[model samples]
Target: MKKVVFKVGGSILQELPESFYKLLIELKEKKVCDPVIVHGGGPEINQALEQMQIESTFIDGLRVTTEEVLEVAQMVMCGAINKRIVSLFQNQNGKAIGLSGVDGKLLQAKPIKDGKLGFVGEVTKVETAWIDMILQAGGIPVISPIAAGEGETHLNINGDTAAGAVAEALGCRLVLISNIPGVMETIDQKEIIHHHLTKEEVEALIDSGVIYGGMIPKVRSALASLQGGVEESVILNGLEPGDILKYLDGEKVGTILSEKEVVEHV
Candidate 1:
């Protein structure tokens, strides 16, 4: 059976609806493909931190996770968000299991720059065996981004990068579900970039500042996933019903990223 990794960001988690869950159920019922879900809860974590009167900071688009903020991030991402998604999948008649980077050492990491970002980690390894066990048990594994560190430490990993590592480790295709439809040619709200781009093209866009701010990290993550041996990677709007399945079915639902065009160039 083919496997695909779907990484849903906090933005989509906040807006996910029953219809979306139903679509996932339909995919399972049809045996379209085996899917493993990895997710983030940025906004929720930030809200919790704010309530605690803790200030948050970011460097290079990655959260500068101080210990206090790291606690909030763990509670929100693993405790709240992970369970909610698992429940939704189960409600849709899909067997789903929630996991964290800490589960069975599923994801191992080291601090990105030690004291620079406090608890922020760069994923060093992923144990795909545990994920395969969950899949074999007919469960969709839902992973949260908090990872336990080596000896008396805890690390906060970027959800997108974590998902990419998981996909690469499993040798599976990756679908990065986000708020936007896909990469845009212009920054205009309606300008959907419908064509596939080479690495050079993506670099040109980055150099031109057409892709800046939050988009820079996301695009870079997608590129990294492609280079890491995943067959393909796509960035699509998850709020739309059936968007992910549509993309998987060879429909032009989002911006697709790959090393080279497998299908007729479109």
Candidate 2:
């Protein structure tokens, strides 16, 4: 059976509607493919941290997860967001299981070297066995991006990185659903980049400052997945109902990335 990894960001998770759930049900009913969802809950985590009066910081788009912020991250990512997504699938007549990096030693990581950013992690290992078991049982596994490292160290990993690692490990296609349609050539909202991009092209866009800030990490993660041997990686607007199916059907639904492709002009 084919497998696909869907990386749902905190923004989309918070805004997901009934239509999205219906679409998931459709996918399951059709047996389109086995899906593993890796999720992040940054907004919710930030809210919880604010409530607890813990100041959060970021360095190079990665959250500087201090001890206090890490507590809130664990609570929001594992306790709330993970379970909520699982319940959504269950409500839609689909079997869903919630998991974390700590579960079954699924994800292990090492500390990232941003000295100012406290406990951020870069994924070192991803075990696909548990995820496969859940898929074999006809259930979706919802993963939270908190990894346990050597010793008593638990690190907060970037959601995109975690998702990419999981996809690479499973050799599955990676689909990242974000609020935007896809990458764009211009800052103009209408100029959506709908074609596949090569690594060189991606680098040029970044160097030209067309891609900046938050998009950098996301695009990099997608590239990493492709380089790691995933067949394809796509970035699409999650708000659009049935967009996932559209993309899977070979329709031009988003920005696709892969190695250089030979194009023939007739």
> Compared to the true structure, candidate 2 yields what TM-score?
0.89
CA lDDT, every prediction? Answer: 0.82, 0.82
Compute the lDDT of residue 242 as modeled in candidate 2: 76
Give lDDT tens digits, candidate 1, residues 98-159: 98999888999999876698898978889999998988888889999888788868898889
| TM-score of every candidate | 0.89, 0.89
Q: What is the overall TM-score of model 1 with all chains considered together?
A: 0.89
For candidate 2, lDDT tens digit of each residue in 1-266?
A: 67889999897887777777668667766888787899988789888887888876777666787888888899899998999998888888878899899888899998888536777888889888899898888788899999988887888988888998999899778999877778887545666574677788888999998878877778888888877777778888788867788887777777787877722211
In candidate 1, clashing pairs total 0
